[model samples]
Target chain A: MDSAISVHGLRKAYADVTAVAGLDLEVRKGEVFALLGPNGAGKTTTVEILEGYRRRDAGEVRVLGEDPGKAGAAWRARVGIVLQGTGEFDELTVAEVVRHFAGFYPTADDPDRVIARVGLTEKARSRTRTLSGGQKRRLDVALGIVGRPELLFLDEPTTGFDPEARREFWELIRDLASAGTTILLTTHYLDEAETLADRVGVIARGELVEVAPPSRLGDRHRAPATVAWRTAEGAVEATESETPTALVAELAARFGGEVPGLTVTRPTLEDVYLRMIGEKA
Target chain B: MIGLAQRQGALEIRQFLRSRESVVFTMAFPVIMILIFASIFTWDITPGVSFTQYFVTGMIATGLMTVGFQSLAIQIPIERDRGVLKRLRGTPMPPWVYFAGKVVMVAAIAVVEIVVLLAVSVGLFGLELPSTVGKWLTFGWVTLLGLTACTLCGIAFSSVSRTARGATATATPVALILQFISGVFFVFTDLPAWMQQVAAVFPLKWMCQGLRSVFLPDAFAAQEPAGSWELGKVALILAAWCAIGLVLCLRTFRWSLDR
Candidate 1:
């Protein structure tokens, strides 16, 4: 199937709270899709439903061509999940845990190679509890991919990583994506979405508000630019312009050489994201 | 499925053994308790049977409870809270395989605990070993049934506590009180009538009584409340508990606390 994940009018509620209210989504084969939202905006709830960890109250859902809630172990073999804070085998070494998980799949990757891919080869012999937080998260990734799954789910995989570690993790995800794995990633980092996702979906108030490539999300490419420059009086002058290049050219001609402190910028992904989520920017 | 279960069992044992504190505490607690109780209670129960002999059987039953019931009850919740069970549930491994692995680990630990307790009883307390194949067979079946019942019950009971500390607070008292009423720390016949009835409802009392039939002298059966070993009733009650425990496990067991 061309679509690795497909959902139609999915709905889920927790007691009195509506977590996912009639949300619909799809991820095609061999594409990286990121789900971005604020906390309590149904990001995790929606991901958990798609992961088969939670049931939807209404609507049809399919992952790898089967209903996750009713899918058997064979279906499970095709999906890999790296949940938040899940690599917690305190007494077992990294290799031991990864090797153990490898036995569950019919076609599994080499546990040692999976470890190295996650940048945890040095810590393979170390007990999981002894590893740093970033290393432990890498182990989580190792276990998630050991089964050679066609579709992988990573929920806030780099929540607590340092900048360097996050970069390394993005590289590993890129490698997986290039190898033809469909990825559904939920991240709070807008830059992560911009960097990794082929298309990012923004969920707000239990519904998907927008879904598009990060570069064009919310018609961001066509949004007016904010052109700012300093006047001779040492005061900042700014105006919204649909044609920033023409505005800058006019300002430069008036100044007879260059506009002082000139800056022209379109809305960033974060700005569009903030506006989509109804947060002031 | 069997292959996965076996691998899981091996991994469970490896993890258990690597945790030195749990190893020392789970196995040694029963051995130490048997030693202390055997020494302090030196009086004879009947004309020939000594209190040490009677107490050793009760301690064996207690060891089975500690390893199968108390330890599993406490450990499972810790693992649940740690996301271990949740992580496993995400895999292709069936749920039954996880429990089968637990059973294997519990049985292995119980075997080692039984050996150590028996050695202490035979060497230090002069407790007699079973003489015939029949008595040895009785010991074997009782150990199996008792451990299975306790393990299943522990897995079911783990669902009641949301955290490991809560499990310890809850399981320890239930275990300690059962030991007191079920003759693990005192004589069965000497216990209060109402207490005896209460203990009978649970599996530990029957486990102790069944074990007594194997370890205590045949003549000591007269001192039992039923005036005999009541092997049939012992087997029946334990088997019933096994059924009840299995049903509870199937109904109540959770892969994570939130679920």
Candidate 2:
């Protein structure tokens, strides 16, 4: 299948600082792709170039088989963007703002349906400025999806959201992905990526260092598991081993059954992410 | 594009009316200034051309300043700073559609201010009426031309403001300076000759002169510049400035202050 996004030798510079160095990326259609990076790591610049909001100094890029640099309004209609900041249209109620933006697209989802999907139905009549931070972010997401875009770009869409709200946002993203929308998401939360992304790419110093499935990224699943248990001495003990199951079995034998606070902890996506970024830096 | 323009125009008008603070500032400031100048300034250029007529003309100019310069400069930059422009940019609406809506709304407000000032002058102040349709036509065209010029200049000024606070600083000084030099603050005849010459280079002077041409009698024009009211030259100059300002605004405008 053709990829949703393709880039090769992409580079961008401003004045004396290089924001995006030569980089290559490809996102297959109908998949959720997460880009992990630190601040000022050229992630935003690269995304802007892909969104046709900025010009690249040198690059080859095609989003959904059309050059983003030359894509017309029709192409823009097929793409959605959830930016990092909120808009304060004080006079516009939630329903009004959503309906207004929905009218711009040729084939828009029902504004009321989109608002309800984003959990803003309760505040539909409330002015946008009066919404809470998470509610405002939901409005931004609602605007992004009103057009029913084929590809959606989300930039830290859950930054200010509470843990519960963040999980709800993850479900929303999953639903969009299941409906065949390709997603390119950028976020600092590793758990969000692990929960939502099919594949994740790590970027550092304007370069892509790694790309793989969330479970397989950076040998995380294969990394030695830490086996911990409370001993008869009333203290904890631990050991890193490739055979965690055997260790647990031996501990079970000594404990005459369920190992005391027995836990085999594996390296999480965050642990692998920090190690990769630390090494790359 | 027209549909988007209509929608945005309606939204802007609604928003402007709802914001009591901005409505008071933009709509009320010019009328209050008119009252202040009419009460404080006693001199007139000629015996027949009363300060009342001059106050009405100055008020019209002040109304243009409020709608064209103050409204766009303050509102546009603040919207951009707040990410309103950026969010709009992501939408499928054409960029020009947003500007078209802004211009239309500003023009409507300018027209209302002009009408109010004219009523105040004719009904209360007893200013002389235009004797001919040609003179009234000239008045309409001049106001249109001046509104166009100010609208374009206002968009251009929006680029200089990165934040809401800086918006006033960016646009207000230019408006005040032009008004002062164009005889909105005081009688132009009282200023030094060099100051009048400098003011002549700006659109404000032609706009004020054009207002006087429509309201004051023909004999008054003979005593002023160019011997008689040159409606053609005023239109051409104002159109040229409008073109230049529009080009600058479109080419240099940024959706985000960071850009």
Candidate 3:
């Protein structure tokens, strides 16, 4: 009952194809959960069903404690959704679009403050069509959060952002999460999931493959670590070790202190995600 | 909800005004057509009714049909393709409010069209204004009903196409053909028997007849197909169309691309 989202035996199909099949998942309140999958992996379909934008063929799906399929305006008001891309409203300025969406919810954030929070303060009066791809993505986020909803859904939010913009966006999302907004986002970007999500859920073929904290995905922390270093002759060497700490100490003693470029690295989230999806496929 | 729809309507109006081609076509072109047709026709439909007056009323019908049905039919599908409707669906506002906003804008355009067309007819062409309270009331009800029917029909018809170009293409053929057969561009009586019979089934024909009933003198009603302006039938047909359109719009409107 405390969960922000819950689904059991969920199923959806279009004509001859099933999009989400017998999926089960739960997102707890005030937690940032990232749903990860590749293209055509039913991530969008599942998110849309949870967002109440589409009906599932069969399921007991509850978002904010209401069945999204039968939820009304009050239920919708408690949920904020940033869809994949809402690139229209070309004639509206940033402030205008944000304010317009703010009108829909009973409790809303200040549109100007929301725009400023998204780092679009200077572009408030600029028409939406003139915004860069990254700026548009920011605008989407601003509008999504303007409702001050109890739950928010972000679908591939930083898809076209530059590295810096993506980082800033991650900071903005982190700020929202810190304010106790339950957020569920979908992304193919494993790094983004690692930085932003408190827990990451991997989905494939309309099923939940794994759900765990980012550091624990693919048993990454428990997996063997690679102890790597540069030798005095400028040659590099690395070796898999169960105890990278012991290995680092041994290397430091052999060099009589400060082994060159000494480091212990674990598998990246990308490596773990790819291996998981690859194994499923 | 109404307040939000009004804001949305005002936004649509601003966007409409910003588009030079749409402003020229949706608002100005009708006035231009009125000037061209009124200037070219110098005869009377009967003894006292000048072709200019008849053309004026018919052009009023043309203006409503264009704004209420043709332009909206085009805009809605384009909005859908642009993900505007989909985005609105995500908001707390009811999806129907989006179309309500559109209806407000289109209805406002239809009203402006009537005013401008009437101004041209009265100020330049010396057409007589309706003198009685009854005639004015008739004008009021018919215009409201006609705009509702046409705009609702436009929203319903938008579901016929998935793309903007397809909507425009679909709306144009039907609207233009109705214009020709229902007396928008010429005398309704002069059309071929088959064309007149075909036009009778649609609401635009009743809309045209209803406008003529309000604007034309009582004697001019003699020229109508039933030898009368048939105001009662006009109201009935347009009301029926409004009911039918509401049903279809509820059934066919799409809030998002797909599941």
List, residue by residue over A231-256, the lDDT tens digit for candidate 3: 88999999999998888888889999
TM-score of the B chain in model 3? 0.96
Candidate 3 - CAPRI tier? medium
Best by DockQ: 1
Q: What is the lDDT of candidate 2?
A: 0.86
Error of 3 at A18 (Å): 2.0
Ranking of predictions according to TM-score: 1, 2, 3
Model 3 segments more than 4 A misplaced? A227-239, A244-264
Ranked by TM-score, the better of candidates 2 and 3 is 2
Worst 10 residues of 2 chain A by lDDT: A83-92
Report the first chain's TM-score for all candidates: 0.98, 0.94, 0.92
Model 3 accuracy (lDDT, Cα): 0.88
> Which one wins by DockQ: 1 or 3?
1
Comparison by TM-score, 1 against 2, better one: 1
For each predicted model, how many residue pairs clash, with residues at least 3 apart or on different chains?
A: 0, 0, 0
Best lDDT goes to which candidate? 1
**Model 3 lDDT tens row, B132-206:** 999899888888898888898999999999888899889999998888888888788888889899998888788
